[model samples]
Target: MRKHVRKLKDELVKRGLDAFLAIQNTRYLAGTTAAKAVIVPTDGPPVLICSRLEFDQAKREGWIRDVRAFSRWRAPLRPGERVSFCEPLQLIADCLRELGTRAVGYDRGGKKFVRKLRAAHAASYRELPELMLELRKIKSKEEVTLLQRAAKIAMNGMRCAAESVTVGRTELEVAAEAEREMRIAGSEGTPFPTIVASGRNSWLPHASATRKHLRRGELVVIDFGATWGGYASDMTRTFALSPTKKQLTLIGLVKRAQKAAIGRVRNGAKASNVDKAARIIISRVGYAKFSPHGTGHGVGMEVHEPPGLAPDSKDILRERMVITVEPGIYVPRVGGARWEDMVLVTKKGCKSLTA
Candidate 1:
């Protein structure tokens, strides 16, 4: 936690800001997702703000010692003010006012938030663009451990999904089975909604599970993730009860494409090149247009994050970054197959964590 604060302070120093305000889900910094806001000043300890409802929980779970709770009912007015402010933004503005902050950096907010903040306080605000992304992309040793555990848990779910898949079963049932297995395997919860797209539904990469039953000789794309200690890992596998020649070919190509993409995941590797490695493989077989999404994405606290592997991406792969290599080919009215695996970027190459 101190290391994260120091990094934020360094960023603040570099940007010439008095403080950085974190209003979004900053579990990566505060060690608790319940924190409503974290005021990271250039000096001294950072302050964590929580709602009166979650104050005790945040105080117990958060690493920041200076935890405060605010409520309109509990606020005391000093002047001829008729009533206390109800919005939590007002409370945060009051904190900045109390700190005498001249300039503040914020992680996320829209025009309304900015206007309200400027109206409430005297400080100038600047959005710290992608600062959190820069910090969250690199996984520490402990973070790697958590992600590895998550990968194992996700693999358990994947194995369950593969085994439970059969004709006459509903996609929702298969999803439930996989989710149950992951929960039993010590996953806190799923990182995202468990996907069990069978038959034609598999044509859509991000299709949701439905009551549609699995049919023989049809492809079922199961994409899911597991969360462990706030870290996440994602994986996808296509299954078929009775495979056809086309299905086998599609699976083989997607698996090879995923392997090629993973092979490109190393320190100093271009994210676009990694995407191209998979794209070119699928393109050779005239399935390029069938694959629309990016090859892969970073997986960490959230299911999808920075360092996207796409043709237009400008991200560079760095060591210790955990990302997914998902290469898929979806054919309209036919079927689709995706093979995804979580990989840990290394100096020389990358190691598959979901294998």
Candidate 2:
């Protein structure tokens, strides 16, 4: 947590900002809203302004030192009248004004608030959504540990889903079994809604589980993730109720493609090149047009983060980065095959945590 704060301060300095801020109501790091605010100045300890309802929890969990009741903030106590936030800017601007800040960088998606802040306070504000993603791209040691544990738990769920998939079983039933296994193994929740795409539905990359029952000679694509300690792990594997030569062939192609992609992961490697390694093989087999999505994405506090592995991406892999390698093939009316695994980028290459 201290490291994260220090990094934020460094970014503030790099961006020529006196301070930075983010607002969120819930304890989720991904949360961003007005009900709760975090103020981090380049020169001092951070402060968190939260509702009285969650003040105690924030004080305990938030790494900030100063915890103030958001509701108690008044627009410069008036002598004969009441003041409100309508006239004053957001708490971030308020903090900067109090610190005599001249420059500030804030999270994105607050055009109205940003305009009001510039009008009300003499400070420069820059939107920093991409900045935030860049800061979170490299995983810390603690984060990697949690991701490894989450991968272990998620693999158990994948196995459960694989075992539960048989002829006559509903897609929902298979998904339920996988989720139950992950929960039993100590997962707080699934990062995404569990997917149990069966038969024709397999062609849909992100299809939701339906009531359709599995049948012999059809494919079942189980894509899911388990969350532990706010870290997430994503994995996917296609199954066959009854094996066929063509089905096996497609699965092998996807597996080999993923292997080639994972082999390309390591420090100082371009993510686009890694994606190309897999795309070349898939495209050579006449299934390039069928695979419409990126090869994979960085996994961390969020299921999909920065450092995307795609043909058009400029992200470069670095040590301690956790990413997914998923290669797939989809054929209309003939079902599809997708093989996915989580890996930790290392100096030499990567370790498959979800293998």
TM-score against truth, every candidate: 0.95, 0.91
Which prediction has the highest TM-score against the true structure?
Answer: 1
Which stretches in model 1 have alpha-carbon errors above 4 Å? Answer: 75-86
Q: On residues 249-335, what C-alpha lDDT tens digit does candidate 1 reach at each position?
A: 999999999888888889999999999999999999898999999999998899899989999999999999999999989997779
The TM-score obtained by model 1 is 0.95
Q: What TM-score does candidate 2 reach? A: 0.91
CA-lDDT, candidates in order: 0.87, 0.81
In candidate 1, where is summed lDDT lowest over 10 consecutive residues?
A: 76-85
Per-residue lDDT of 156-266 in model 2, one digit per residue for the tens? 998888889999999999999999999999998999998899889998987989999999989898999999887899999999878678888889999999999998999
Pairs with backbone N, CA or C atoms under 3 Å apart (clashes), candidate 1 = none
Q: For each of the candidates, give the backbone clash count.
A: 0, 1
Model 2 scores a C-alpha lDDT of 0.81
